[model samples]
Target: MTVDSSIMISFSTASKEYDNQTALRDITFMVEKGEMVFITGPSGSGKTTLLKLIYSAERPDSGHISVAGWDINNLKESTIPLLRRHIGVVFQDFRLLANRNIFDNVAMALRIRGAAEREIKTKVYESLKSVGLRHKSDSYPRNLSGGEQQRVVIARATVAEPNLLLADEPTGNLDADTAEGVMRIFKNINAKGTTIMIATHNKELYRNTGKKVIRLDSGNLVDVGKG
Candidate 1:
């Protein structure tokens, strides 16, 4: 397959196996820079596995994977950290530190990248504002509601303005209203040109979004079309 210059992620017939179980099978697709894509499937359908490959949590047993123009299929362990700096991740459960305040949690990403204290403060506040959580900067994660904590997680992930954001069931645990609110934050971030790929079971979130949809079934690509 031809690689497009604007492609931010490309999987060329990649396959991955966990022991005797196959997680993905010859998955070939490309995600353009700044595009928002959704992966949907039933339980154990490889949605999480695909996202793991892009972020280097797992490697394919065959074929190739390229992310941000880097040949990550064979990427060195030493360079994994370098690649992750440009990527952000959110999970079904909020992974914030209970001991840290909201501001500190959001600032952790920048601090890990060796950002200056003044700069980290500025960027963290801006990210919090974008997620509509600036008022809770001093509150701990345990003190906020589930939706509020998830928003804090989003703020933490985007504090550095990553090129790609991968979310796995980000709103899976929230109510309908809260889930819609979280998805709106994702749409707003995508509007700013950050590429986003979400693996979710909530079909309602993608119904009217007009985003690209990728369906996986039994480790195979069953469908690829726009919503």
Candidate 2:
């Protein structure tokens, strides 16, 4: 594929290794601005490792990764927060704080950036509303169902209005119906022109989405096409 000048993500021969195991091998691809893409593979196929490399959670052992024009392979520790502010990440596990209320949980993203109290409140509620969870603002994670908590996690991740969002097996824990609902929320977010990359092993999630798919096998890029 020909990479455009405005590509939001670009990987050139990127590779990552942990101990003796290679999580990724010479992976290369580019995602244009505002594009939605899926990284599909089976368990232990390095889907999670790819997401981690993009978000700077894990560095590549060789090659390059650039996100929103920032070179992740050479990313500095002090600048990680700045890089993350423009990128949102959703984990398979909800990763919500059990002690915090839904509102605070979502608001935390804005708060860490020194946003004003009023702005934080507005953004948090707006994000919650997007996930259909505004009414549960006062509830804790323990009080919500699995799907609801995942939605809250989504809300928190996106409340910062990131330029790119990376989700690793977002629907892995939800039932089919609930997973569909989560997918809809992602679609709505994508409609607003925010780029999204979802890592999922479930074929049902992208069966008819028509989004671009990057298929991985044994840490290698096997195919790139429509879903």
Candidate 3:
């Protein structure tokens, strides 16, 4: 497929290594603006590693990596946070603050970015509503179910309206029904024009969603398949 000039993510010959083990091998791909794509593979197939590269948590050992036009491979330490503002990331582990309530946790991103109090309140509420967790606004993370906590994490990741959403096993901990619901929320967000790259092992989930699929095996990108 021809990559559009309006691409939001681009990785050319990207690779990552840890000591003697290679996490990714000469991988190359592009996610265009407003596209929803799935990244699937078995465990240790470099799905998480690919997400990390886009999020700037890990740099490529060789080759180029760019997101939203910024050169991630050459991005400076101080500019990492700046780059992250344009990308939302959801992890298998919901990284919510144990001490904070749902509203506070989701609003934390806006607070760090110095959003006004009124804007933060409005945006946080809307974000929570999108994930069907507005009713749990005052509840603590520990008091919520696994799916609820994951929803909160999703709200936090998307509250700022990021250009790209990188989700790694987002539905890994949810039940079948709940996972379907979460995937719908993701689809809704993607439909609104944000680019989405979901790394999952659930082929059924991707198939049901009808998004473009990119399969990986042992760090190599295999093929782009239809859902």
Which pairs clash in the backbone of model 3? none
lDDT of 1 by residue, 139-220 (tens): 9998999889889989988899999999999888899999989999999999999999999878998997889999998788
The total of clashing pairs for model 1 equals: 0
> What's the TM-score of each model vs. the native?
0.96, 0.97, 0.96
Kindly report which residue stretches of model 3 are placed more than 4 angstroms away from their true locations once superposed: 1-5
lDDT of 2 by residue, 50-141 (tens): 99999899999998899898988778999999999999889888789889999999998899899999999999999999999999999999
Scored by TM-score, the top model is 2
The candidate maximizing lDDT is: 2
Question: How many clashes does the backbone of model 3 have?
Answer: 0
Q: After superposition, how far is residue 198 of candidate 1 from its true place, in Å?
A: 0.7
CA-RMSD of model 3 = 2.0
List lDDT for all candidates, in order. Answer: 0.91, 0.92, 0.90
**What TM value does model 3 have?**
0.96
**Residue-level error in angstroms, candidate 1, position 29:** 0.6
Residues 1-102 of candidate 3 have per-residue lDDT tens digits of 233569898888999998969999988877889999999999999999999999998999998888898888779999999999998888778789999999
Ranking 2 against 3 by lDDT, winner: 2
Ranking by TM-score: 2, 1, 3
Over 4 Å off in model 2, which ranges?
A: 1-5
